[model samples]
Target: MHTESQLARLHTADLLAQADAHRIAAAAKPPVELRTRVGWTLVELGLRLASAPGPVPATA
Candidate 1:
């Protein structure tokens, strides 16, 4: 059985995953209005890169 903390962590992870998926999808197909906005493409690219799974940060 999972502890309360574990369950909470799992929920948080799931939410993060869903958010990342949305970000990636948005980046893949940005809105026409967004295309006209200055620096919007760069913002989308930044979100895509940030959402990608990578090495965990070193705990101090």
Candidate 2:
């Protein structure tokens, strides 16, 4: 008979395998609008930081 710990491990392993499959599927999808939006946002942020005056205060 499977002990509780063994059953738990089996369940966890199954979940992880499913998650890995999902991640691979997501990676295979074509680039969507959100990717462009996020990329442009990063570019804008970089430009703003480049244009900003003065050094940022260092925290202790």
Candidate 3:
């Protein structure tokens, strides 16, 4: 249970980090092509994180 909680927290942090990165990139006003690439990459990362398997059950 403890390990599962920790994993959850880590996943949450990862998501938050991704969000921050997206926000920073959006605000930087980079070239359209670069911005689009970054945006897609961030979106893909978020999707992968969201779809990732749940934490494994801790062994006794």
Candidate 4:
């Protein structure tokens, strides 16, 4: 069986690892403003596509 100290150390290590992982993940994501801009741009493009008129007829 493990000692109480060892268990405590293991728990601390696990918490530190989780914190490090979260930090790295947060760094890897785009900034909130940029993400919001891209999201709005995509929505505008989708709206324009949906409202597009049918293709024009070709002259003989």
Give per-residue CA lDDT, model 3, range 1-60, as digits (tens). Answer: 569889999999999999999999899975669788899999999999999998999999
Model 2 misplaced stretches (Cα beyond 4 Å): 34-60
Against the true structure, candidate 4 has what lDDT? 0.96
Error of 2 at 42 (Å): 24
Worst 10 residues of 2 by lDDT: 29-38
C-alpha RMSD for every candidate: 17.4, 8.1, 20.2, 6.7
Report clash pairs, candidate 4: none
> Cα lDDT of model 1 overall?
0.90
RMSD of 1: 17.4
TM-score of each: 0.51, 0.53, 0.45, 0.55
lDDT of 4 by residue, 1-60 (tens): 999999999999999999999999999987889788999999999999989997989999
Model 2: clashing residue pairs?
none
Candidate 3 whole-model C-alpha lDDT, 0 to 1: 0.92
Against the reference, the lDDT scores of all candidates come to 0.90, 0.96, 0.92, 0.96
Error of 4 at 42 (Å): 16
| Better by lDDT, candidate 4 or 3 | 4
lDDT of 4 at 47: 97
lDDT of 2 by residue, 1-60 (tens): 999999999999999999999999999998789889999999999999899897879999
